[model samples]
Target: MLTKRIVPCLDVNDGRVVKGIQFVELRDAGDPVELAKVYDEQGADELVFLDISASHEGRKTMVEVVQHVAAELAIPFTVGGGINSVEDMKAILRAGADKVSLNTAAVLRPELVREGADYFGSQCIVVAIDAKYDEETNGWKVYTHGGRKLKDLDAVEWAKEVEALGAGEILLTSMDSDGEKKGFNLALTKAVSEAVTIPVIASGGAGNAVHFKDVFTEGKADAALAASIFHYKETSVEEVKSYLRKEEVHVR
Candidate 1:
């Protein structure tokens, strides 16, 4: 069995790490490089650095910051935000990012997903979908521009499309559960996971180890990502992994 991964998410803005609830009211977490070193030491299987404001600010991901953080980690690192072209992906990858995650750019021009995967190999391409439940539609609606704009796309359908476009993984974030600390959106996670063959990394609403366990077993997530909980020291990566181990969930 493949051991599940525990990933610490560093939502960076202006070179500093930050986290916010439902994509608003940001709070400073720490410096990205410092935080990445800490998580890497804590046995985190992977690290995700999202330049949360890069897209909204109309700029590419901070290459200097990505390089600094990547230099400190021994584990796989994924970077996202403001990556609109294959050249951007190459720059980040050359800077040491193991994977490049595309969000708004991928939605606006899906061929970018295929182009990126083709140029860098599918293993290096990750398509992130930020979604919220739409009660009227009876399905999750995809959101963009830092989760401020709701697209006409359905989350599950988009996940399938990105997979067919050659993305290696899908980082699914439930805007509804983001920063709520209740738990992951198991329904959303499982829906996308089942719709695509690529590995799904569940993002948003992870308050404790049990939540991780639930997402893995019920949500069918290959990995679970947490921000506030891990950033604030409310929960450590090892504790979550240990809890999952007790629950008979395969974890590294």
Candidate 2:
């Protein structure tokens, strides 16, 4: 059985980790390098460092910050935000990112995904879709630039498309559930997981251990990611995994 992964995200803005509701009203969380070390010591399966504002600010990812965070951790690290081209991917990888997650960049130039996959292999290409429920469409719509821009792309279709383009995984974050601590968006996660063959990491709305269980068992996500809950010392990764183990969910 493949063990489910528990990942903690560091949403960095202006060099500090921040958390917000529905991708707005940001609040400070902690230092990315410190948080990365904490999560690594806590046995987190992977650490995701997202420079949440870089894409919106029209800047490149913080290579120095990536190097700092990566140097502190002994686990896999994924760096994202403002990754626009093959050169950007190489830079992040060279700076010590185990994987590169593409959001707005991939949406604007989808060829980046194919090119990244060809150059770095599928395992290094991660397509992260930030989505929110659309009232008009009555389904999740993909958003970019930290959920500030609404695109006409369908979440499910995008999931399939990225996988077809050689993306090794999909990081699906629910704008509605983000920073709410209610729970994961199970329906949205299930839909995306079913739409793609590669692993899906469910992001947003994880308040408790049960939320992790729900996402892995009910949402069918291969991994579950949260920020504030773990950052604020609300829940520990060990506790989450212990509960999942009792629920017969495979977790590392």
Q: Number of the top candidate by TM-score?
A: 1
Candidate 2 wrong stretches, greater than 4 Å: 19-30, 53-61
lDDT per residue for candidate 1 within 130-207, as digits (tens), equals: 999999999999999889898999999999999999999999999999989999999999999999999999999999
Write down the RMSD of all candidates, one decimal each. Answer: 3.9, 4.2
The prediction achieving the highest lDDT against the true structure is 1
lDDT of each: 0.88, 0.86
Candidate 1: pairs in clash:
none
Model 2 residue 101 CA deviation in Å: 0.8
